[model samples]
Each structure stands twice: as C-alpha cells, then as structure tokens.
Target: MIHFEISSYNPVLLTNSPLNIGVVETTLDALGERLLVIDRRGKVITQRLVPANNKLAIIVPFEYTVNNNLMCILLDDDAEKDGELVDNVKAAVIDMKNYTPPV
Candidate 1:
C-alpha cells in the first residue's frame, strides 16, 4: 500500500490579470509513481509524473476561474495490474475570490 501525505494552501492568489496564479504546492511523500488530478465528474484534469523528491507544485492557468473541487490520486507503478487501496487525498478547493476583473 502506498501512503501519501498531502497538504495544500487555500485560495491561491492570482495578482497578475489574465496571467497564471501562484503555484499550488503539494507533497507526495515519495510514494506513488504518478499523480492524477481529477475533476468533480471523474475526469482527469491534469497529471504529474511523480519526481524523486516529495514536493510537487502545480501552476493554475489564467483560463481557470471557476471554483473547482479537484481530486488528487496517487497511483503506483503497477496500478493497472493490482488495485491497491492506497491513501485517498482530496486536493484543496480552488476558489479565486475577491478577484476584480479588468475594467
């Protein structure tokens, strides 16, 4: 079983208008071989190849402005063969509030 320690910050600030916001920081605890970010509808929003280090950061593009609840799942190398019940981590609900549109 792969165990992952995931933590995240809330409401990442996007100061630059029409630009990418601050990065979303996450730690995989050096467990899974890959990380998948899924949306509410079980859709794969993004995927990251887990690195050797435990730290992983994701950048939110300017196009995404809706408040979305994403699911971060860590899969082992042999995830397809053996369905191991590893740790289940829910990523932070990204809501960009207090963002004033350009006039």
Candidate 2:
C-alpha cells in the first residue's frame, strides 16, 4: 500500500468570479520528492516538481452559472501514470464531492 500524508486546505482561485476550493496535499513516494494536489473533484490539473521546501499551492474556479465547485489534483512528471492516477483521481473526486470536513 502507498503511504501518503494527505492534507487539505482552502485556497483562493484567481478569476473574475473567483472560487474557494479545497486543496489536497500529498507526497508521492514513487515520484521522489514531489507533491500532489487533489482538488475537490479529484482531478489532476497541474503537476510540477520543485524543491521539497518549496510551497505548493493551487486555485480552483467556481462556476458562475451553476455555482458548482471544482477540484484539482497536482502531480509530478515521473508520477504521471495514466491508469492508476486516473482511477485514483476518479475515486478522489467522488470522495471530495461527498466529503465533509471536520470543524
């Protein structure tokens, strides 16, 4: 099993409408020292490898018409595995939608 230290935080999305999306942070051991961001929808929007000390942040846009929230997952270059990532992403998105963060 993969041991991932997952953390979630609120981030502001830069856009005309703007958005308050939840950002999930995790480190992929398989990809060396890379951080992964799993959005509320469990989708991988952007992934890049930087120094471990570097801060990782992401912003998601809220739908203006539907008022629906969006999510994004960050992955690194070597961590880009189509099959596993996609499956995990799908599951993550489902969890995000129904996830209720503790107060």
TM-score for all models, in order of appearance: 0.48, 0.28
- TM-score result, candidate 2: 0.28
- Candidate maximizing lDDT: 1
lDDT scores in order? 0.54, 0.40
TM-score of 1: 0.48
Cα displacement (angstroms), candidate 1, residue 100, comes to: 24
lDDT of 2 by residue, 1-103 (tens): 9898759877876445432444433333354444443444555455556455444433333331133333333344565563224223221221234445332
Q: Which segments of model 1 are wrong by more than 4 Å?
A: 1-22, 62-68, 78-103
The CA lDDT at 25 in model 1 is 57
Per-candidate RMSD, Å: 18.7, 18.2
User: Can you list the residue pairs that collide in candidate 2?
Assistant: 37-73, 37-74, 39-72, 40-71, 41-93, 43-73
How much is the lDDT of residue 42 in candidate 1? 65
